[model samples]
Target: MKKYLLLTNEELKRTAKPYLIVVAVLMLLEFILTAAITKMHEGKIETFMRENGVSMQEAIDAYGKSSFAQVVASGPFLLILGAGMMVILISAFVIWYRDWFGKTNYIYRLLLLPGSRSSIYFAKLTTIVLLMFGFVAIQWLMFFVLAPLHDLLLPPELFERVSIAAVLERSGLMYLYDFYLPNFALIYLFALLLIVFIFTLVLIERSYRKGKKVIRIFLQFVILGAVYGATLLVINSDHLFANEKGMLFLAFTFLYLAFLVIIGLRTVSKKITV
Candidate 1:
């Protein structure tokens, strides 16, 4: 337990600087987006009033007031969403490469530690999951701030009342950052399963010779393809198991998750070499 905690702390320390920068930058950009989008919305209302010679209330009634939901649908927000997801997925993969990339051969030292390699594996996985949750928590809080800021920027008559929940619900942001317990739990499990799969694939292929490396890579993709294919097959087969396909699929995913973790632990402990 002590070793695992210590290794987890080291992993967090490795990622702290860039991780904090991404959080801070995301917060600042979100603030700017809220203000800029609201101002543009305000300007649109003014233009409507000017062209039609109507009052603010009339313009709003005619043009429909803007809300945080609209801001999320804007191109800038979608771009940020895409970029943030890319950063997250890249970070997940890069956490492994960081130790392997340089001349230090850090993985050798880690593997040689006087303990089960599972400690190292769990520590890295825990660190990545923690960092991801931290980012999500901070972003969740930012939405509260941004929602009110959005409301305050526009004239009351030109602003459609919107709470954080309403904004997320209406904009479909909930799909990306769903806070509901069951939904979030499922997403978290899928994320864990994915990270484990990626870790296993890298371990199996990382040090292989080029000829064998290609084969290993092909095998990794084949596993991935099989998972996806099985999912599609089960999900679309409505007649299977009297419409209990959801439970069946969950069972299949759980089994696959266990398989990946088992293979990963074994590969790290016995197979991989410096």
Candidate 2:
């Protein structure tokens, strides 16, 4: 347990301060952007509502729904891009960091210590997974926080009509849970699975003395995509009914993650240099 904590501390120290700063800055920017866009376009929004088949009263009654959907959708794409870039940046850092540590002599030094290599690998792997998960959670929370502020900027009656709670009750939460949540979870799991596989590929590539790294990575991606395509074909065929689609996908995700973890462990446990 103490060793795990130490591993956690090491991983936490890897990019904690920089990552936090970036997250804070991006969240603040998103919040202010949403609020500012709302306020700035409030008049135009009212005009659009009036131009549409709605009166001022009706516009006021349907603030976020009728007015802010376009802006909200496009504005949040930037946040999504930012979050994705962060994930890639951090994942690349982890891969490079391992090689960096090896070059710095810490690889041999740490391996010589009274600890299992599996412990070290799993600790780092767990840390990276947790960090990636935290990144996803933060991005979602940021978008969620920004979403309602547009409604908040409207008049009281407008806000009352497009209230976040009302939106949730109407169709948002249903659509989210029914349509978006499962897919998002699937994508998140896919990203985590990719990261684990990439880590294993890196370990394997590094085991070689020559220029097999790029070839190995390319082949790995090809094989991974083929596997994913085959799985999707199976899922989309007779395996899943309409009512059972979401559950099937969710189950497949859990099973896939487990498979990746087992494969990762097996690969990492084998003979490999740092």
lDDT of 1 by residue, 1-274 (tens): 9889999999899889998898788888988998998998889889988999988889888778888888876889878766766677677778878778855778878988898989888888888788777866887788888888898997677777777777777767776577666567667788778778778777777657778878987887898789879887877875777437756667777888898889878878887777
Report lDDT (Cα) of residue 194, candidate 1. Answer: 75
Reference-based lDDT, residue 155, model 1: 69
lDDT of 2 by residue, 33-101 (tens): 767766766776578686897776766555544334444455464554456556654664464355446
Per-candidate Cα RMSD to the true structure, in Å, reads 2.2, 5.2
In candidate 2 the C-alpha lDDT for residue 110 amounts to 46
The alpha-carbon deviation from the true structure for residue 24 of candidate 1, after best TM-score superposition, in angstroms, is 0.4
For each candidate, what TM-score against the reference? 0.90, 0.68
In terms of lDDT, the best-performing candidate is 1
